[model samples]
Target: MDWSTKRKLEYFGILVAAILLFVVLPFFIFIYKPPTCFDGKKNSDETGVDCGGSCRLLCRAEALDPILKWDPRIFRVSLGVYSLLAYVENPNVSAGVRSAPYIFRIYDKEGLLILERRGSTFIPRGKTFAVFDGNFSLEERIPAKATFEWGELVWSRTTVSGPEISITNKALMREETTPRVEATVENKSLEPIRDLELTALIFDSDGNAIASSRTFLEYLDKGGEAEVVFTWPQPFPTRAEVCAAPVDVTLVLDRSGSMDDLGANPPQPLTDVKNAAVYFVNLLHEKDQAAVVSFATEAASPIESVLGRNFEAVKRAIERIAIRETDIQHTNIADGLLKAKEELVSSRHASAASQVAILLTDGVATRPEKGGDPGYPETYAQQVANDMRQSRIALFTIGLGKNVNESFLRSIASSSEEFFLTPTAKELRGVYKKIAEKICTTRAAVIEIIPRIYPR
Candidate 1:
């Protein structure tokens, strides 16, 4: 406990502390690492373990959700095999998912879940894509509806655009028997491309994806080309409407004096007839051609002599046909029939399109007098109707009001179903609507195979 002994002990302790601070502490500081985004720790201000807060990778809660761009599509490949396709969208501009887990559930007609398909797919950067699952056997269970679901996706920034390739010369053949698609794929990039994948989609006339198949080409040299083929083991169902054919129809209307016998301000039956004719013309398909023919003392193609696809022009022509005060008292049914027949026969698509003639009359045919009285107008009209049918033109005749001769109007039609008698002008619109719908429904069935190459 003397001063010399105490001083010596303190000196020794100070020497040891100085050595530790300079040597051991310096070594530890040199090996130390600051908190980072990829360090797999939450030391820094990161939201998750190693994500968010200045990291290229975002946390699950920070990333925006992917969108289901379209409803899932299901197609039967064979007896029990089905193909499922789900169109997806990544709204982020520079962020994407490398691989994401997803689920597909198929439901029966009773709304019971029948199948659950689990799979994983890589979502590319900055685009809408497709995730497809195929060759699923329902085993006699038919799917009434299919749903697509997915869990949290790990998103990170990526600008990689995979495999610069182009598709060309696509051809779909043997659609009625065995459907097969033949196409060529070529690499446009200077570097070699590997594992090129492609998906094929067949859309119907309504642009709905009906059938799908996927094909792959393992590798391609720089600027190299190869042929890719996709085939369907089963043919598509033909009962569904693939195409709706255009129709060529001529609307024949009577503008005789008795048409306005109800004596309204704008004329009862005549005004209603014009409105019904416009409604009927509007109901026709956008590609259908229509012509207007009206008859009072004489039949005339008022605005246009030729059939045209311009439905507005056809409506205008029908509206212009009026029983004006200057018009004389006569109904030339024969001329109306002949004018309509002429328009239909000379139309541009006479052979390809469905031909039809709708005749509306309010009184008996009493024009073309032989001795200044009235000729055999009824006989001429009947003969023209028969001739119209011989040209494969379906005829529909409408008798308006109580004054019309039902027997004469019926004779002008091809069959009893084509004849309609309306006791009041108010009922005429409904009759015209019925005929318009019939014309649209009876459009000849056409087959078409649409091929689309979706890029990934």
Candidate 2:
């Protein structure tokens, strides 16, 4: 071996060893990182990234169903303005670059498009980012099924990597379950199951299972409560509620020739009558019905027909009733009550609830055939009262001003407790609520009142 040849050979060998130790070894180390396979690449979070033979990132597709740490699945529609949420979750990425653009598609059955939304955000890694609330409208009308995806920025370019979700419609109402009646089968299960199939046999007050409503339980997570609601039109008896239910009330006001006289209150009979009638109507609930019947010589047609469901309606009806104008040739108490009763009776439908009539008269009854007093005319009043009682009607009588027969007015009332015998004109408004309150009180089938005895 020559000395020069041997030295050159040794240098070549050292060079080969250095290349393998530094360059080739570092390349192999980078290629075999923890997420990398034997091939060499960075694994994607959800979508499995395809490294594709010596690429830095092993991008197959983002991993689907990344364990959601802060995923609040149950949400309210009100939280989002339009309807898009940015979902971001990455354990390794920086807080700033953690969140990416997400495309949300709400679909219906038959793969119909309901809503499609896009949102970009800075998602915190490992933390669920659902803050983006963009207002969007749903195109399709579907009962429940919905799906969402997060990955690609565009709908067409969406890369399915984030959570694969089976979106469900949030509960329509918060209190879905109501307190069930007693004597029913009790569910002993502690874990309240929502969307559970259940069969219910409904019974009337008579204890006969008349009809049944099919429904499923909706689970509310907060209080561990479950509510099941169903729609079934059961054969409810003609619920004879006196005045609690929404009703059309007509106040028959007597404003005839006899009402012109100023009795205890030195205005006019018509003045007190108008004031009292106005006050009475105002005391009614907004859902209640109201009309003022001011009768004079020619009997003015209902000043205001059935009104008073909203503020505007009640205000307008009050304005009409309070109008100070009349033809005071004669008084017609019986006629006004009869007309009011007829109006109320005719306004109701076969399916409607009961109606009420409040008749206010200052003086006695007078007509073409009969004049002055007419012996109180209790017969006509009684007839109207009887008719009302039979038809499940409630009649409230108010003896306003002076020259009013308290006994006759009492006889006209469906019940003795409903007659309003007021001594003063100014107290008319207070009396109105008292009468209305009496009507609004729950009228049950039967009540057994036990008198309480006390020693003084």
Candidate 3:
């Protein structure tokens, strides 16, 4: 009787085990899932929610930060209205964000916040793009500084591709007082592109971007081209009053014996300097007045307060400047600057317009006796530079040759960036052109509205 009961129990146990293995286990397996990257919970080796480690997209800490190529630039459109542009670059080739918030802060000259505008835009992957904000108006406040700041960005993995386009030709033209730009864009891509956005940035010769504008194209077939135009109802700050606003500029030339040393190719330092000076004279617009002061041991004006419109006279004066042959044929930079200041002050256009002095030197200030302090020409030059700064006159110093004291030149200029150091006299013309552009153009009102992007 006991063996029969035991056998029945064993058979019942085997039947229960088979049912659990075949039916119950399969049912549980059908409803179960393994941990994956897209799952709501971060169970794998992920650094953040569904990111880092095995995920295609990187975690915030692992992703590269966006590069700001340049600071935001604000262009005054009218008395109260303005336009703004910020150039930003994404360094990651495969990371992109659908939307990124940004802020443009406008500040007064005293660094007081006038107003701020906030907006959001998409950032193209691995490409530099300009964020344009336009039609910003203030009742009577004028912005002296504008700054751009980006908010927290949520980047996602994306495949980025775009139509290849090239700028063929571009020019800035003013119709009356309004500023306009005409440019040609050519599509070189094999595929057609639609809704193409084009941006135009106008930079002065000093590489400071003054204005920016944007245009759009509906469609562009492969290998096709389009003419794009950007215009503003208000004139640029440089051309606000056209040639009516006068600028009195004095040229301070170094006529030391060392000026004969030709470091430039073809070896003609004086000739090159004169040619560059003449070129600078020609660059000045009408209603601007210029004077040439040559110096060695002494400073003398060749073209004493000549009007900029009298181009021939200015050229003749520049060409006539010769190296001093006296026993004291040493650089007297202080004397040259003082003579230039006198010319600028005595000019009829001086009081009504901007005053600028551009001093080009090939050697150190040698004639310290002429500086009113023997053996302290640099200190005397610094004093003169300080006086020029106090007078609100912009001073630009161009240092030619390797021996030219860069530190002294920097001290003489209004700012370090305003000092031009050229390895050879060949680059003097280019440097002069940049200075000329800055002199002729009005100083841009720079207002840094926002701080830089902070690291997390």
Candidate 4:
């Protein structure tokens, strides 16, 4: 209790502490350091190698890989310039990566790798974010396919919520010349949104993405709106000839004795002809009207009394067609042409629609019996075709077999190029599809609409 005794005891305690720091502690540390999360090894309370249990690196198995809502896509921005984009989905709640490395491989029609784009992006949390690379030039090569791959990913814990932006008043225009997609991007949140990137995708009526463009928004005040327009320097590209105008087409098919020359009961070329006609009908635009006009000894409307937008009905009518089994079964090309012209001029046909008649025959016109002239049927068919052509009816004539008079068929077509020659029944579908593309295929639209934002 005295001052001197207390001083002596204090000095002894100080000596013991110095020995532990300089000697005892060093001995224990030199022998072995206890397992820690920072050791880069799976030890201690960690679940996987240096991950979880107070580690910054998250366990890869516990994380969800981003989804590919669609494959990588390319859109032409100008003559040879293109924009590459893909939608990556990160659904992990309250988690994201600071930087994500990605690679996109663009392939041509032959499946050869034409271009490879590599970039890094911030993985926005719990949303479909876009990976975009602009100003990519493929010169004259057209991209037919693209593939995406992810690089080494290191996910960390974080929270991210994208800017509240809404797209409205979307309109697509100038698709035939230079494609344009305009839309208003409005910031819906009270806070101003900064560094926003917008993408517009043009979709065809069939919902297939045909085009895409990228734009940047540096900043937008809360409740502010900005009109963004996407323009492509070139008119949309199509693999086949397409009609931009509305169409009203009639399939004037021959259901005569020659069509069933194979004697298969259901028929050979006729059966194939029906299938081709149905394919053509199914390819028509939603507003387009199709009529089935079949002729043996005389023309008849297989659809009974209507030519409208009901393509399935028209297809059914074409399927129901069979070769006329009557004793006077004859190929009446003139009657078929007349019947098609009548159907095209019907009230069911839209006033603005382009009137087209696809005339297919497997044999020479044998009707309107030439008592004196063997060429009478051909002359009569050409006269009827001339009348229809003068009435503004475009004709596409198909000579389906060796028996068909190619010269007469060519004369029936509105133009020489409108004539198609099919050497076999199996080749009819391709011919029909080509014709359908001429009248029915729509312009390319954007592939998808995905907006990504960067807050920092």
Candidate 5:
């Protein structure tokens, strides 16, 4: 064959091949299936229907397209950890479709599949429809850009329902450290969440899913409380401030005759107690609250001092304690400690960092008038100390005079180490100074460290 004849024959073959490829390639490249609601959107005569088009994407076999339409795709979402949520619009026709099950899926930033779920609904006739509550973890190493796709939504002539789903995640701070988070889940729907499977996904600073927990429970009701707690799997880069409770302090003063003695030192023994108590009160932070109680024959009072933004008010209350004894009979240490504890525990701010009762005495408890009498000074101090302990109020005792019963004082304090037995009146001021230091040194939060391979 000649060169021109060969070229003409080759060109004819190329034209036929191009025509065939154009017809078949598009069929695979894009799907052009009829809208799920196509038939339903039309009239009885099968006309005037808002079938597949950009204007509206639904049509029904039975019902005609109403001027106004209801959006069939509806859903709600919740979170168990920090997560990302989104939605997508169906880009298909609008006929014979009542509702279509919206398949929700989560993908990592790298386009890896993480989770998927299909909502319940039948595609009905409408101009517009929407799918909601597409949720994924913020912990999933999200790439710069991520995408979402719905599963094949089918048209169903019968009724279909949607599933109740939720997504939760831990909050991440600027440093990308996992935040301490607590979650509560309640079954507010009419139906019970049977065999509910819940998992909490915790993320790291780099947006990676690091830790997870599966929670199991019998059942959750409308008003039920299911508390789930999660912490960072790795230690935070920097330590955060710990939250400590406030302090509840009750000052118990000695009002016996010996308390009236002037100390060899510049400040009298009683004055030292007053000075120490006032200084401690002055040191109280905005979070700390204090009260005063004094005893002579019996514990006479729990005088409430106004809560101090600063310590000035507390000092005023302490200095105002009456030097006059309620009764000149004898010291009733037990009555005083007990009365002080009762008042402290009943206080609104009782459950604080340091729950303390400070007992100051310049003399021993009243000696027993009768062997079996329960009102003896030793018996009263012991009984009161024991009773205060049962109430969980920690006691710090201050003994001022040489005659002060060291052993008896030990028994009244919550802990022997917390008790202070000053051998002479000269040491009373130092005792108060020490007490103030102890109260202020209390830590903000209860911290007990347990060694672990990796913290979670």
Candidate 6:
């Protein structure tokens, strides 16, 4: 009786299990759902809506910061019109933003806000791309400082790639007052390209970027080439003029006993000063001329004139200036200025286009009287500075260390910007470099943007 009952029960259980597997299992399979990226729900392993799990796009919080290589470059297009360019890099190989808000602010030399441009542009993925703005007009203000900043962006996975454009046969023509740049742009991509933006930057012989221009192309067929020209309304200074333009620069350095003080980080004030002076000499253009004058109680005589092309001679002259160890530790600024003036007027460089005097001192003017009765040395130096200005020679003054007279140095300089205060010898090289840059460059009158399009 037990065997027969057990067999019947087992057969009944098997029938029940088969019915559940075939019918009920199919009903549940048709009704249930799994998580997906496009479902608009925070399901699956996603950190945010449709991003940050296995999705290619990243959430805003997970994105890395954008890298700006340098400050935005502003070019003066005309009297009041300007052009701006910013180079930015996106580190994420897969992340990008279609558009990002940006602000370009222009400030005057005194740090006064002049104008600001607010705009948005496409931020390409991966590699560096340039953000450009043209024809920014300010009624009468001249910009001295320009800054560019980007607003928050939503990063997404992108398939956008740079257009395959190659530049060839680039030539800069300076025959006219307006300089022109000729270049051929080739499109190597399989598809036709349109509305391509191109920019050209003009650098001086010293590798200082002086001017920039931008142009656009309407269309380019695949494997086609088009010639484009960028011309400035105002002719660039001729290469001959740039190379031949004469500049007379005289460096007046203080070699007083206090100069031997261990003020610099390595405690080498005199050596640092010599190095800085040599660096300044090296920055001069080939046609420019330089002179060295050192003073303690009195100025050095028999001023040696060194051509900029003879950089080694100038550096040797600078290194030869030695600190005075005598009882007279007085800073005879008047003697130094007088000697510099004499050197400038006597040298053939008197006819130079720009004559500049750079006076660097570590202490106050102590000798009011070089030989006569006691007189105001500071006043005498100021008068000499005025006379030099009247002669069309610009004067720049650098006050080093804490004992220097800022007011006196400021009075000697042609303008506020011409006076540099360096509390330590470590900054002497940078100051000298700045002065050299100012002396060697000329301001461009106009920057022109010419756009030409060729049909592929």
2 against 4, candidate with superior TM-score:
4
Candidate maximizing TM-score: 1
Q: What order do candidates take by lDDT, descending? A: 4, 1, 6, 3, 5, 2
**Any runs in candidate 3 off by more than 4 Å, and if so which?**
1-31, 239-456
Estimate the TM-score of every prediction.
Answer: 0.58, 0.45, 0.52, 0.56, 0.41, 0.49
| True lDDT of residue 108, candidate 4 | 89
- Summarize candidate 1's per-residue lDDT along 365-398 as a digit string, tens digits: 8876666445478877888988998998999999
How much lDDT does each candidate structure score? 0.79, 0.50, 0.76, 0.80, 0.53, 0.77
Q: On residues 320-360, what C-alpha lDDT tens digit does candidate 3 reach at each position?
A: 77765557588889888887776666635556788888999
What does candidate 4's lDDT look like per residue over 255-374, in tens digits? 887887875766887887888777777677777787788888888844443578888787778888876555858888998988888888887889988899999998898887878898
Better of 1 and 3 by lDDT: 1
What is the TM-score of candidate 2?
0.45
Q: Note the clash tally of each candidate.
A: 0, 21, 9, 7, 47, 3
Tens digits of per-residue lDDT, candidate 6, 1-456, equal 699999999999999888889878888889877777777777778999977788765788888888987788777776778888776788887777767899999898899999889998766667676777888788788788889988888677766565677787777777366777888889888888877767676766554456677778888899999998886776543232233356888899898878878854333588888888888887787677888888888888775443345677878888888765558577889888888877777645647457888999988887757476354888788888888888888899999989998988998899999999998888988998888767766543222232222222
Instruction: Name the runs in model 1 displaced over 4 angstroms.
Output: 1-22, 26-31, 40-48, 239-456
Q: Estimate the lDDT of model 1.
A: 0.79
Top of the candidates by lDDT? 4
Which residue ranges in model 5 land beyond 4 Å of their true spot? Answer: 1-243, 263-267, 302-311, 325-329, 352-354, 367-375, 424-430, 436-456
Tens-digit lDDT track of model 2 for 1-456: 999999999999999999999999999998865654333333543233333334333233422333334322212232232233223344433122334465566655677766666665433333333333333444335423334555642111222233211112212111123312111112334433343333333332233322222333344232243334433222222222233356667777665555545553444655665666666666665456665566644345644554334545544553444323433356656566667766676634223445777877766665533456555455665666787778776888888766777887787788788787776567777877787677675532211111111111
Off by over 4 Å in 4: 1-46, 54-57, 109-111, 140-142, 238-279, 285-320, 323-448
Each prediction's RMSD to truth = 11.2, 19.0, 17.2, 11.3, 19.1, 16.3
